[model samples]
Target chain A: MIPDDRKYTQEHEWVQVEGDAGVVGVTDHAASELGDIVYVDLPDVGAEFSAGDSVGSIESVKAVADLYIPVSGEIIEINEALDGDPALVNNSPMDDGWMFKVRLADPGELETLLDAAGYEDLLGK
Target chain B: MSDLKQTPLHQWHIDHGARMVEFAGFAMPVQYEGVLAEHATVRDAVGLFDITHMGEVFVEGPGAGAWLSGLITNSIIKGEPGKVTYTAMCNEQGGTLDDMLIYRLTEERWLVVMNASNHDKIVDWMQRHLPAEGVTMDDASDRTGLIAVQGPDSQDLVGRLEALAPHVAPIAELGFYTHIAVDGPGGEWIVSRTGYTGEHGYEIYLPAGAMLAAWEELLARGEDLGVRPIGLAARDTLRFEACYCLYGHELSEDWTPLEAGIGWAVKLKKKAGFIGRDALAAQKEAGIPRTLIGLEVEGGPIAREGCPVLAGDREVGHVTSGTFAPTLQKKLALALVEKDFAEADLMVEVRGKRLATRHRALPFLAARVKGDPRAERALS
Candidate 1:
């Protein structure tokens, strides 16, 4: 069930481009593999980060995973709703569970990410 | 992966969409529906577990009781038939080798169930110390299978089994740490009122070939009762919330039973000179060096295993086991720290950040294992 309107990373994160910004979140596969999400740690809204930098982390009942920035940009906003219920990431990883929004630093960097088919192939689906 | 062993229910787990992982050299199910769900199932409802990976050994003969009493920290001679005693085998220096359950089947027969990870080590240790004539040790791990159904509804689930019908009355009234063995056509079924989880439960030990039928029967009968197959991940969390000592985590060769908060199982005045009696007795008189303490972390980040425990800036000890306890809905950890600093203000360094923590009592949740099942039913 890889979403078509987004680009994905090998680390199981997906970013959807909206105008000059990109909304990022972990894919459904990653969320399912992590079991029940118990906690989420996100960077500040105004934080700046380069591509491939660890912006935050997601903690499940059994394990922890680092959230990586797929494209270098400034974090414009984070999903404040996650602070109340982290299970949203498990229940709706593609929509309401979206973690943060980034102001795209370079529009060309989006092309370097894998498309829906490529991500599906990476997951061996 | 090909070299890894598989239990009789391996195919059953796969057929049920369980996620498999290699643990203790066995290809075992790590999860089925999920850890949190399976864990909640065991706490609220009933959940089945294929624990066939654990080791079982039979020690029989005239000297079985006395021989075993001198080998373990707990006195086996004090326990009567149909009783189970949880004890630890230790080295000469009083370090824990492994924690196990000793089931006394008769005056001359006893069964020892140990962790699968320590199967070979414990078997070898027992063999090395075998007395000349009276004690005979038979390693029946490969031929044995274990199934556990744990939760508040476990008794009602297990009592419905046809195989246990003849013993059902006694089984229903079975107290904690007691068992009843039956000689059936399939073999000897040793059903014990015991479990690693804090919930009320029973563990059934039977022949390996009989496991599949028993597993299927439990699922079929428990369908309307909300019974689910649990996995090892939930097993760990359930035991953690119960403050049970996992072999590699809370109980290790570096820590003694007293340090692991299971000193009640260790007896130094039992007359029989167990392996670590002298050292353990001296340690008891001198005072335990470290004590296991529970902690509640303030923030989101979980203080996982191996995280350092700090008193102010000085490093005190490390976390033996830590996780987000599902039932308690709080971040908790069991750390073995210096006894003097156990009650002091503590901070656990998790992923390079120091998280504020407070000393909490053990067994984050109250255990329901000792409660009367019939009384609970009447109240409900």
Candidate 2:
């Protein structure tokens, strides 16, 4: 199910804004399609990225996909638990699987993100 | 997509929520539940595979052994009945046409199991040279269903098949590379103590009509042993860890068996005058220019197939089969490299960046082949 609260990207990442910081993670569909999450690669905290930049990557047994930053921001904190238990991304992509927290560089970039209905329409679901 | 083939267990896979993908013209399961979980299940316990997508061809005649000996690199004439020999069929230029397992069913009969993608190629290659008065080849792929039950506890699961209980002795005592014909729900099938994964396992080739029953029975009986259906994704990783060559990836028409690390299987001294004997023997005398070596990357970015292998500033080779091995927990790859550059301590270009790598030995993990003299006593 596409959650209504967060903004979604065509790349399948979900972003939720809390004050000036945004929490980011992949969508449920992305996690399901990748099959067992074997490894997750994230950039170091304090790293700045432009909107749609390849911030990191996630690898499963059969495939690998580059993780895109949904909006331009500077990474503040990353979920360190994922280093040992990458399966958390598959188990709870929307919540505990959140990859990192970033302080927004420009709140205007969120306007380009898709709403829940738009994301569902993009999936044709 | 319309011409894509479906195996007998196609619907069964879909019903189990398998994510399907087009592989060699068949809609096969890439993963089910998850690839990591399925891989771990096979490594630690037992797992089943629907390998009906593989091709099975039979040759039978008075001259079957002698005729096959001429077409393959292995000495098939010396292999007795019920024994299996892994060999590579090569072109006159010594490039591999396909690597297959040949089972001598009897003095006049033989079964050749080949990769699905090379089924037509192998058939045409054999037919062109088949002795007119002797050997006859028949394609049994459509009627055959191959199921691999692999892991340490696979033997116990096979013993519980009620319909197959009477034939338990062969299953219990079957040596590696040996097979036995058993009467079962499928009328009759060959149970071979052979597997692609490095684990101790059995591959059952039976009638497609009776595949479902066998699959269900294996799952039902293997429940306590944690037997689950494994997908192709894990199958590749498992075989990769074992350093098994995948046709299009590692073994190919452009590479010879000598360079692919199967030189031991090439019997050039045999007097049968095999297909590529002259070329392989000539290469042997001159020494193979390239050799296949295993590589382990430091971390994250995987070195996939076709990735260039670097020796300082010069690109010396390319990766063939690579993966993040589930059991070993390392990003490993098999690369065909210049003989001089195959030594330990190398690097690979992954995603435009060079990653530090080390040349590990083949079969990253110790193989648990049943009859290997050096194999540890434990089944795993």
Candidate 3:
């Protein structure tokens, strides 16, 4: 399920816009598919990335999945708590498990993301 | 491009919402509720596994013991009736063909439980070595189904099987690696006190047609005790934590028994002259070049199969199986490294980054065997 307040990416990342910044995290559907998340690889703060750029990765007991930057932005903060407790990604993926936040480089890039309805349709297949 | 083979319990797995994947040519369930939950259930409580995809080959008739002893790396002649010996069938080059359980039912009859992926190869290999007019080999894989009830409470679970009431007490008291023939409603069943997971468990061999009923009975009787149907994914993790050698992973055609650290199973002085006796004996005398070692990663990244093992900058070996062990709560791995680096703390290249890891002893977790009360006490 996708939250109405956040825009979704085809790769299953969710971004909630708050002024010039957007909070990023994987959707519940993605977390469930990945099983128990054991490790989360995050980039250093202040790192810059373009839209759809390879950011980090998430490792579960089953396999590893590459995390992608949704909209072009500069990294502002990361969930440091995940370093010791990665299971949070499975327990509270939408809230506390949020990977990082970024300052949006282009506000217009937000238009390219999928809405709740579009993500629901995408998951239906 | 043919359809994947389905176990007799396929429909049941589907009804339980099991995620199915192709393994050893069968559409096997990889997980049901989840990997972590299923793994922990078996470690702490009890769980059932549908291992029907594993192959069962029967070797019977005159000279069966002699014939089997010549083929496998273990001393088969020493095992009495109802004895089960874990051994590997190797080629003349000392390469492991497959690791299996040899159940000696009688002097003239034996049962070999083999890996599903190597069923055809092992059958063909045995048939090629047929003893002129006495021995007969039968591949009963398609007609046999195996169910394992494993954990600390496994004995209690087996006693709860209504059909096995008359035969339950002996089975519960049976020594480790021993089995008994019990009569089920459908026919005679072979219950063995052997398991891949390092838990006290039993492997029941029943007719394929009778497996569904036996499974249902076990599940129903053990319901209050939190018995759940475990999948292949949890099976891998459980056995991995116990440091059991998985067919394609730890034991393979490229490695020998001595190299895998299971040399205790190989009887070098056995007079039966096993297929790879000379090569294994020579390898033992000269010392194996590469040995399998257990590793514990310091950080979070899970080192998986094929990851490189490094002694400083030099590549020493590659990992066979690795995962975040649910029981130990650490990233553990089994690697086959050069004997020189087998004892040294090494580094592993996981996802292109070097992570500090140390070579620990085999069996990252302790097994709670029922027959051995001392082991049970030690485990506690």
Best by lDDT: 1
What DockQ does each listed candidate score?
A: 0.89, 0.65, 0.74
In every candidate, what fraction of the native interface contacts is reproduced?
0.89, 0.58, 0.63
Error of 1 at B316 (Å): 0.6
**TM-score preference between candidates 1 and 3, better one:** 1
Per-residue C-alpha lDDT of model 2 across residues B1-380, encoded as one tens digit per residue: 55889988888999999888888888888888777788889888899999998999999999889889889998878778989999999999899999999999989999999999999899999989988887889999999999999888888888888866888887888899989886777677999999988888899999999998889989999899999999999999989888888999989888799999998889998886888889998988998999999888876578889999998888899999888888888888899999988884678997788899876877787777755423453211
Error of 3 at A59 (Å): 1.2
lDDT of 1 at B380: 7
Off-target runs (Cα >4 Å) in candidate 1 are B373-380
Name the regions of candidate 2 deviating beyond 4 angstroms: A44-47, B371-380
Candidate 3 share of real interface contacts: 0.63
Candidate 2, residue B257: Cα displacement in angstroms equals 0.5
- Candidate 2, lDDT over the whole model: 0.88
Model 3 agreement with the true structure over B293-324: per-residue lDDT tens digits: 88988885889999999988999999999998
User: Is model 3 an incorrect, acceptable, medium or high docking prediction?
Assistant: medium
Whose DockQ is greatest here?
A: 1
TM-score of 2: 0.95
How high is each candidate's TM-score?
Answer: 0.97, 0.95, 0.97
Q: In model 2 chain B, where is the ten-residue run with the lowest total lDDT?
A: B371-380
lDDT measured at residue B322 in model 2 versus the true structure, 0 to 100: 83
Docking class of 1: high
